[model samples]
Target: MDTILYPLEWFVAFVMVGFHKIFSTIGLNAESGWTWALSIVGLVVVLRILLIPLFVKQIKSSRRLQLIQPEMQKIQAKYKGKKILSPARSRPRK
Candidate 1:
């Protein structure tokens, strides 16, 4: 698991270090605990901002599925109790 997640860990460390550099350059004390904590908060905010589009897309997809649920239920009802045969088992049609 650690090997699988090594890249992600590296990316997270890179983001935190980059934010720490930025904060330090803006006059925050490099040795202060607040500086390190703020870097974590900044990373969270940045990641959230980057994921906004994916979150919106997921919401839209779920909404579409919800809207189509009635039709899906109707199809399921129509097919209820029917045995689905494979093509090789089915008779050829005229």
Candidate 2:
């Protein structure tokens, strides 16, 4: 997935640079790199805003998992004896 998206990311970066250059040639305020930088930053802010709910959900899930860790450990310990089988007996009969 990253391999596919990498080129697109680069393309966006190149387009931003090209846009800055073109605006500079046109004697507009867009010549300032900050225009492009701030636009990218704003885009990130919007995306983060959109993901806030998902982020909150993840935090809640993480907290719940933390709370359950002790119980999980207890379950693991209860199953520990069954998990340790002799090496010869561990092989499948097939």
Superposed model 1: Cα runs more than 4 Å off: 76-94
What C-alpha lDDT, on a 0 to 100 scale, does residue 79 get in candidate 1? 97
Report the number of backbone clashes for model 1: 0
Local accuracy of candidate 1 as per-residue lDDT tens digits, 48-78: 9999999999999999999999999999999
The top-ranked prediction according to TM-score is 1
Q: 53-85, model 2: which lDDT tens digit per residue? A: 999999999999999999999999898868678
**Which TM-score value belongs to model 1?**
0.73
Runs in model 2 with CA error above 4 Å? 1-28, 84-94
Worst 10 residues of 1 by lDDT: 85-94
List the global CA lDDT of all models: 0.96, 0.76
